[model samples]
Target: MEVLSIVLGGGKGTRLFPLTQSRAKPAVPFGGRFRLVDIPISNCINADFRQIYILTQFNSASLHLHLSQTYVFDSFTRGFVEILAAEQTFEHSGWYEGTADAVRKNFIHFRTQNPKYYIILSGDQLYRMDLKELLSKHRDSGAAITIATTAVSREDASQLGILKANKNNEITEFMEKPGPVKDISDFKIPAELRQDKNGKGDEYLGSMGIYVFNAEAMESCLANELTDFGKEIIPAAINKLKVNAYLFDGYWEDIGTIRSFYEANLDLTTLRPKFDFYDEDAPIYTHMRNLPPSKMNFSNMNQSIAAEGCIITNASITNSIVGVRTIIESGSSLNGVVCMGADYYESEIQKQQNAEARVPNIGIGRGAIVKGAIIDKNACIGEGCRIGVDAIPRVDGNYGHYYIVDGIIVIPKNAVLYPGAVI
Candidate 1:
């Protein structure tokens, strides 16, 4: 079947503030080496779905650069992973108001392909899925739309669209971010569908924000002037249209907030993370940085993942994800932090200029302490500085060069913290 994939590059991502300040949500760096957008696009490539388009509107420069640098298909194969930023044509003049509206504005271009099915995916989610199987299930069920749902704990139901399927696995109803667990009765999964392999069932099916829409049916659905899938379109289309549920059992994470993003990255440093990034058969792909392996000199570290091109010297590190080109100097302590590392290695000439200017290269400095923080790219923490130690809790404040979000100190790109600076 001919399929076209649409990865929705989400809105401003206000919940993830400073990280999304200069880049789109999907373009945010992830796992020290990859971007969040890479997750969905990698899944598409692994599934052999190459005709893909990513939709975006806000802070897309970094995203555009990342897309151009990575994901190049041969010209003759008619495959591409292209970006369609929000544009104002004579027909529409405003920015995308919602997810469905974004697609509706792009329908003119999307309809050109005349694909049999359209697979819609979220750009910020972390998962490994095969759209080929999703399409197969959609074809077998003969449904107008197939919504992918995964069983999630009751605690997570409040943050997701809870789905209810009938005895035949046809979606009977869906409640988007329901208020309380008791209010989920209208959209709770049936007992048979809820039964686990071990015969212990407690979780409810939650929407993964993945959908397979019959192309023509989707066109019609959008023709009604819908603005969102979960909030407006899918919820209204359930009883009026033939909607089915596709069950997916695997690890999935929706990293759409600061706390969630931090926890997800730190989770990777575990013995066996919930989401494995080292699977050889179905590996995640990203832009290759041909830098030397990490070099450490008497650094005391444990339970961490240090990426390539890092230089460590007698630093104390633990339970952290040190990104590429990171420099940790002596007498520093980094615990439970996600150092996003530097964007580029400073050349010898640049280093000389920095030295002449008395500017330190981006890194954690001597005698500094960084705990429970997120150091974004190109940040320079000065000597004897303390961060996240006396940081104001649960506050969002900008300190000229750095930001604090929910008590986590975040150093924006190329920002510097002077020596002896305190949180």
Candidate 2:
């Protein structure tokens, strides 16, 4: 089947705070070396669906650069991939109002290509799945649209795009981020999940915000007026359309917020993490440079993922993910931290506080210490600096840049931390 994958990469990821202040959420550095969009794009290629297009608007320069290097659409015969930036024209020239609007604007291009199915996806998530199975199910079920549903905790269900389905796995209702008090017990679950077989009360399968739509039906729906798939489209089509629900009981996480993103990264460090990126059959492909192996000299490191080109000296690092070419000096200690490239060493000493620019690589200066924090690219740290160690609040020169959350300090991109500064 000819399938087209549309990854939504427009969200500013405000919940991620300092991380997304400069780049879009999908383009943010993740898991030491990979971007969040790598999860979906790699999944699409692994699933044998080569035709892909990313929809981007907010801070998309980095995302576009990454996509250009990681994905090669020009070398394929029957496959092509590209990014569609939001544009305004005579009839439609404004930025995409919502998810549905983004797709609707791109429908003109998809119509020209003429694909059989459309796979909608979110950029900021981590998972592995054979999308072919979902497409096969959608094709066999004769539904106008098929949604991927998964079970979340009852307490956390309110934070998701919830779905209500009938006994035949047909969706009957759709709710987007409903409050915790909302009751959705009327929906029916699968026999295996049912408290009583052939009973009434359902498990309330929540929408994964991933969908497979019939090209004809999708084009027809897009031709009409709709702004969001969950709020305005799916709910309106629940009674009038044949919407099948495909239950997925595997590892999946929506990294929409910083807390979830941090927890997800930390989860990878477990003895048996819920999500593993080392699957041989479905390996997550990323930019691989022929850099030399990471060198650790007297580096008292334990349980840290040190990427290639990292140079570590007399420092103690535990449960941290260090990016490429990162330099750590003597007497520094890092625990439960994610450190990206930072700029520190300059040709000459910069006297102005703001004159200290971010380094092209990350560095933990001598006698510096950090714990339970995420430090983004090109951050400079002076010796004896301590960060993300306490609940003390600190703000950037501009008030709207960053806010500490739950004691985990978020160091924004290009943020220069002076020597002896403590958090």
Candidate 3:
């Protein structure tokens, strides 16, 4: 089947403020070495669905650069990964209002591929699946649309679009983010679909924000002024078209907020993360920097992940992710930190210039004690810095040097913490 994958790179990402402040949400650095956009693109390539288009509006320059540098298809194949930024055309001059609107605006470009099936994906989600299975289920069931659903708890259900499906896997009802007050007991997965025969647990089928749509069905669904897929399109489609559910019980995480993003990255430092990047059978692809291997000198590290081109000297790190080109000075200590390393190494002349200007170099300085923080790329933490280590309550907002969101300290990209700084 000829399939075209459309990844919706969300707008603004207000929930992920500082990280999304300068770049698109999907362009935000993730897992030390990869961008959020890499997840969906890698999945598409692994599934042999290479003709992909990423639709974005806000802060897409970095995303475009990353895509161009990372995904280069060979001439032998028709595979191409392209980005379609929101444009002001004569027909529609406004920006993409929502998920469906983004795709609808790019339909003129998508039609050139002439794909029979269109796979809709979210750029900021972390999960791995053989999309061939989704297509197979869509074809076998003869459904106009097939939405990938996952089992989510009641607490999580309130934040996601929940649905109920019959024994035949046909979606019967759909509700978007039914808040705590809404009684959604009737929306639980059918007893037949439950692996537990007793059906004793309350497991609701939550839409994964992943969908497979027949070309005609998608075109028809978007013919209206409906904007979002979850809020408008999917709910309407369930009532008018033959919509089915593709049950997926995988480790899927929506990296939408600061808390979720922080926890997901920290989880990678665990012994066996829910999402593993070491799966050689289905590897996650990213930019090939080919930097030198990370170098450490008497650094006592445990349960940490360090990417290439790092220099560590007599520091202590625990349960952290150190990105490429990171430099941890002597006597510094880090725990539960996700440090996005520098973009480029500073030359001795640059270091001298920094010293003259009384600014710390582009890395963690000596005697720094950082914990439970996210240090964005090219950030500089000066000597004697204390971040997320003090016994003080922090309100969520953007400070001059750092911001605290979800009670976690976030040092934005290119931000600097002066010497003897304490947070």
* Whole-model lDDT values for every prediction: 0.87, 0.78, 0.92
Q: Candidate 3, which segments miss by more than 4 Å at Cα?
A: 195-202
Q: Which run of 10 residues does model 2 get worst, by summed lDDT? A: 194-203
| Better candidate by TM-score, 2 or 3 | 3
Ranking by TM-score: 3, 1, 2
Q: Put down candidate 1 lDDT per residue, 138-236, tens digits, no spaces.
A: 999989999998887667788888887876779887888875646565555656566453233546888999999998889888887779999998988
| Candidate achieving the largest TM-score | 3
lDDT of 3 by residue, 1-423 (tens): 389999999889999999998999999998889999999999999889999999999999999999999999999888999999989998889999999999998888988888999999999999999898889989999999999998887877889999988889999989999988889988876665665322335478889999999999999999999999999999899989999999887788999899999999999999989899999988999999989999999999999999999999999999999999999999999999999898899999999999999999999999999999999999999999999888978899878889999988999999989999999
TM-scores for all candidates: the values are 0.94, 0.90, 0.97
Error (Å) of candidate 3 at residue 41 is 0.5
Instruction: Give the 10-residue window scoring lowest on summed lDDT in candidate 3.
Output: 193-202
Model 2 misses residue 65 by how many Å?
0.8
Residue 318 error, candidate 3, Å:
0.2
Q: What digit string (tens of lDDT, one per residue) describes model 2 on residues 139-230?
A: 99999999998876555567777877777888877888776787756543554774421232335577888999888878777777689888
Candidate 1, residue 74: the lDDT equals: 90
Clash pairs (backbone) in predicted model 3 = none
Error of 2 at 177 (Å): 1.4
